[model samples]
Target: MTEYKFSDRAYTKMIFHAAKYPHLAINGVLLAEKGAKSNSVVIVDAIPLFHQCLYVTPMVEIALMQVDAYAERENLVIAGYYAACENFYDNTLDKVPAAKIADKIQENFKGACFAIIDNKLVTLEQEEVALKVFSCNDGGRWSKSNYSLQNSKSTLEAVSVLLKRGAMKDVVDFDNHLDNPKHDWTNELLNKDLKQIMAMY
Candidate 1:
């Protein structure tokens, strides 16, 4: 039998839950924040397809079920696999308008899709803790974005100065080039970061 390891909050919670409601006892379940479409799992249940976990707990199960509810009312994003990724963003994804996206996904999932509306989907599992980021203080960016390879040194130096001063810490910038303007790496970074933060919450 293959053994699945529970590595995150969602996975562990799913394991605990399966013990109580064996019918709904999914071998494993991935989680995410409420409104986020990152498909990131805060906690994860690591159950092997034909194997089992070392141990289980009811308390943990309760917590796992509560992730979505908490994210709904609090500061987290929540969405399961199909809902988070494929079914999410109906217009952009499933092509359903924001108003009817839930219903559409539910239909798509054959009436078993889990979804939480309210847009606060980014902060479900935990409270927002103000990160004390050490970043570059580059108030002199955007101007240097047009720097070329011939002048990459000066442009890079400017950004380096910003980094030295602490600019990258104030806001998020996964794939943004403070000194380069030829790259449109926005969607990838934004989506990646969104998913990453959603799972952590």
Candidate 2:
């Protein structure tokens, strides 16, 4: 059983991406480095891919290529995929959009995990991480998997503050970048701000 540890940057960005477009389905890739322990993956950041046309391929391919190149330069791997369903009640694996992308990620990285944003938990008052992780089995079935959040308590608190401050608007996705090349989907500024805010909690 491989363990997935999500850094505050990764977790908060995923939540922010979904929150930025509450009525649409959102998807992204997770970047990670091998953890100190065997069978552990530490997800350091998340690259938001799309909030529109979740089933499209051309855009997805282009985004993946760019993200792959960026990950390589950063010494990270695309370790996982994440999605936030448009329907508030659809948090199950079957409801995960563009699941083929996740399968492709697993094909490349056997330890790849899929994370679904739990809409009900995506609130300022929510105390727990709003993600449900799933690992694919040999039979190609996705089952719930356990994951840990780096600085769980503070991460939640920081996210709450960020939401209240309407910081989610600062999050950019591939769609935004496509509309305006200058919109940096890397979210470097947001990551830095999150780190500083999280430290205070």
Candidate 3:
């Protein structure tokens, strides 16, 4: 059993992508570094895939290659995959698409995890931070576990810049675009965060 630490920036990106496409389930890769002394992983960042289907398509495979190359340059490993279910109450990550994606991730990185964003808490007001992480064992069985979050000023800066540039909307690629009316909730949430960040300056 390894402990996982989710940096503020990494969590922000995960939540942002989830919020950005509340109607569609979005998936992405988690980048992390091995900790000293103990068997632990510190998630540094997330690379989201706004365009994904029920199956991992050729495009998704190609995108993964790019993510791998990027990770190499950054000196980080592909730790796992994170996804948000379209329905807020659906916390099941062992289903078709998630299970299939996690298998691919495990094939690449041994002890890879699959995290599901807690959309119910995220979309509505809640006390707990919105994320649930699951790891695949040697027997290829998935198990739920707890993770940590460490806030970083650098992450806040990065998220703020992306918001200022409207990067969320622009970064969506390949499949369906995020033109759904439900995006209003996401947009408002992001705007509120951006404003709070601006107020600090």
Top candidate, metric lDDT = 2
- What are the per-residue Cα lDDT tens digits for candidate 3 across 68-177? 87778867878888888776678786542657767887787775777888777663332466778877766778888667766544444555556455555533332433
Tell me which of candidates 1 and 3 scores higher on lDDT: 3
Ten-residue stretch with the least lDDT total in model 3: 177-186
Off by over 4 Å in 2: 34-38
**By the TM-score metric, which is better: model 1 or model 3?**
3
TM-score of each: 0.22, 0.96, 0.72
Q: What are the RMSD figures for all models against the true structure? A: 22.1, 1.4, 6.8
For candidate 1, write residues 82-127 as lDDT tens digits. Answer: 1111222221222212213223322322212222111122122212
Q: Please give the CA lDDT of all the candidate structures.
A: 0.25, 0.88, 0.65
> Model 3: how large is the Cα RMSD against the reference?
6.8
